[model samples]
Target chain A: MDDRPGAPRQNASEEIEALITLMAKLPGLGPRSARRAVLHLVKKRALLMTPLADAMHNVAASARECLVCGNISGAEVCHICRNEKRATGEICVVEDVADLWAMERAQVFGGRYHVLGGTLSALDSIGPEDLRIPKLVQRVADEGVSEVILALGATVDGQTTAHYIADALEGTGARLTSLAQGVPIGGELDYLDDGTITAALRARRSF
Target chain B: MDDRPGAPRQNASEEIEALITLMAKLPGLGPRSARRAVLHLVKKRALLMTPLADAMHNVAASARECLVCGNISGAEVCHICRNEKRATGEICVVEDVADLWAMERAQVFGGRYHVLGGTLSALDSIGPEDLRIPKLVQRVADEGVSEVILALGATVDGQTTAHYIADALEGTGARLTSLAQGVPIGGELDYLDDGTITAALRARRSF
Candidate 1:
């Protein structure tokens, strides 16, 4: 006999539990959210879950990192790296694939991208060799890149990586620049942080 | 040349976009969260995404509704309905499969469940026939059920449904009861609504 007072005699099947565990590991999801997502998927299996499964299967089997730029793709090289029209002698550097995707969403930069994988972190024992900095320098030299845009974050590690990249590419003659810091569009001054306010003030322009 | 200022030369591949669209439609996910989940899945394809895909495929292919109850399962009758040890002479009625799952999570209810799918809503033109009421009545008469626990929400439609079920079961010997309304565990009094406080006060038991 089951000892628990109100507990169900049986729990969810092992397969379901395994799926929920894996889902909980996803970004922005915890155990509760994962359980909810799995239930929703199960309820809409025919309409949503089956198609999602197929898509995941396809991507999992085919997805690979671009050899030249490190962006994710179904081929040896990502589309952005292969696009001749985007070979505009400029390469935007970002920390991770998510940032690369974000830059793609903005649709502003017209050149290619080089994903650094992560910033140089001393605490984590990450160094220049751990990242794609050497490959970036090589790309700049081989591809005759005119500029390297460091679109890194304002965090300490981000700044450290940016400076390191600048020093690494000093002799390569490729002009290096970082994204300008300022108040975001539609941002309230009262809510703005001191660093942002100071940066906005320093980079202030005539209206 | 691409006309968009900062837009990527190309958007995500068709398969990826399809996956993102389906993911966005899930209960807790939106477009941005869906994108992040998809990217995380892509990055962890070997360890997480592949297994998740397989689990979903298996569940999608085999999952079905219990014939006796409306709970989701891999079998026709579901494990709970088939378990003879769980025949506790009680049926906890709920509005949806999610509610059933929640009750199961609590591990308090030891009886079977009858999912109503939805409440009787005059505003939405939903009547007793639209839900599993007739089936529930048939179950109570045929299955030797003694008690019917109404685990439905504390809404007007829920109360209306409970009363309607009671009326239907008047000839039968099944006793009907609803979940007690009260302030939830760890819930702040300041945050609780008037109705909850009143219910908690009215149902107060001696120490």
Candidate 2:
């Protein structure tokens, strides 16, 4: 019941507790799971903990957001932003660096990317100035981009951000498009959301 | 589908991927959650990642299994094993160090512990020799322990290990006892399994 900051949680050692608290701060992890992870790591200190710490420290010291695209990169600009072959007059806009990486994992996109960092959210008070919207607009104008594909989430914030960007780039001669919203590959109708089912029906194509 | 060791994983950087791969090796984490955790860590390198890495490295170097009881501790012998006040003529045996910590969190037992490291499993080729069984026996004999408590799991292997230890400790004049099986605190009867209900009924206490 002690709610004071840094209160001891009956952990064995201060070092272990500190490590567990930090691990708990990570996304998708809570105190119990963090403790479990720290125990697992400690049990395999030589085989896993040391190497993981070394790798995390190296990344913490070296990883930087790409200066141009806002993607996480070791260099000032990411390889995708620097690669000339990817400058095919098409640019994909994603809400987060994770999304950009997901797109890359698909290996279907050969164009450049602009990471929005996060979508606009009125509830959260996040506006155009809060995100990389200005930078994205500047990139579209300067890179001779012909198409700006919004590969954002299907959430309300994502749709609003896409609309805002489309409006901002009006008359810039760059075709504004968003990713088609339909049932995902391997998706089942039973598990699909109502919005998705409606969108799939609206955007249906000839088989 | 490429199962090659250290195969590239389409990550933005090798350092990031290495950290994620190590994280994925944790007990409850998967590749997706590891990537999410790494991304969250990278985003807060200054606030969380660097300190977590430092803590992990320190624990990796300093945290050693207690020479006597196999409990993880900063020193060669854990604080619990060396403490003079906790010699309550009782020793609780647990399957893992996590179980030891859980017992400590309960703060009810004023005794020592013997971490088994793992239960005896014929399927996994693990025997009592692989655990700290001989050490427990030596401690019981040298320390004049009056009672040995088994706070192990309810599973088949846990029962088998407890029975094996009980058989080994016979004729030593020490009382052998295992943790009681019953409905957990705040447990609903509807969710109770048949075996647990049966055990609770057999071990019923007068109201």
Candidate 3:
């Protein structure tokens, strides 16, 4: 059906269409935005498009999951995992590497991290074995970790995963804890939901 | 000034950061959305990231502007310009290749096109010489184009460019015309701007 009597029409060249289609696959970009991005890239072929293409190529060739923590890094083991000073006897467990990066951006935790990759989900048949849970358990025992902070989300699956990990490491003698749920800093009490208000009141401390 | 005493901390590896920075430069993608996109790309490295990178590289290497019409294509000339059946003695002028693609999508015009590259701008110091005005004149003369339709925007610069081209092609014997100024299809009169309403009223047609 190369050129039938009534073949489907194409808007632009196949190469441009292919670029737009792939651009649409990225997070937060739809078909319309992908088309706009493609046009913009074509307009700035040398300055933006070629450099972006090169960057994507380099990242694709080099980026790999850290063997120790599951965070995406340029090396087999990420910088945090390789840093001896970051081992601080604590490993913050997060559901995704994005969350790990978020924590790092805040510069709050000095210890290393263990990305769970995902929380337990019975509906999707995702279990502890499916994620980095086993590796987390092994790290706790081998590394003599003193504390395992569950910085996972407050969703039901997140809590279930946290509790499951706590039970899994019962004999490891590591102190297990989770992030507190409450009114966020700079949050208005009037805007908060009842659950948040209740949690903040229950976890309240002296002024 | 890397690793100096109290240097600024970085959240992710340099490669990942570079990818995010480049991604943020894309249209409709800000820093936050770019970070999310980079994370998604990293997670699907083999499936999506590699293919996208390859696509971009190929497009960047192969894509070129059509020598005659200024449309981006893999070949020296675009399919539209090369299609003998599309030589309908009419040339539709547009502001950009994106607009040319839009016209192709509509599939209303059955003739060739001329991409003006950009509109005339006095504030930005853009002149007729900066655009494809000379080339359009040569095309109108050499290609024996009978009707030159100006499909530029309603903006001041777009109108100014259209008028300039009209004056430039006065003795070329090509009938100079423009897209009708009216309320757009599916547009409400109440929601329309004053200038559009005035134009529509002045150029009103009989039922």
Top candidate (lDDT):
3
lDDT of 1: 0.87
Q: Pick the candidate with the highest DockQ.
A: 2
- Residue lDDT tens for model 2, B1-207: 212365443548777877878888987788878888888888999998899889999899889898887888888988898888888999999999889988887768989999999999999999989999998999889999999999999999999999999998998889999999999999999999999999999999999
Question: How well is each residue in B1-207 modelled by candidate 3, as lDDT tens digits?
Answer: 212234356667788888888888888998778989999998898889888887887777788889998988888998999999889999999999888977877778999999989999999999999999999999999999999999999999999998899999999999988999999999998899999999999998898
What is candidate 1's lDDT per residue for B21-128, written digit by digit as tens?
787887788878888899988888899888989989888887777889888887888888998978999999999887887888777888999999899999999999
Predicted structure 2, TM vs. truth? 0.96
Interface RMSD of 1: 4.4
**Which runs in model 1 stand beyond 4 Å of their true positions?**
A1-9, B1-8
Against the native complex, each candidate's DockQ, computed on alpha carbons, is 0.53, 0.65, 0.49
lDDT winner, 1 or 3: 3
Model 2 CA RMSD to the hidden true structure, in angstroms: 2.0
Off by more than 4 A, model 3: A1-7, A185-194, B1-7, B183-207
lDDT of 1 at A70: 90
Q: What is the lDDT of residue B29 in candidate 1?
A: 84
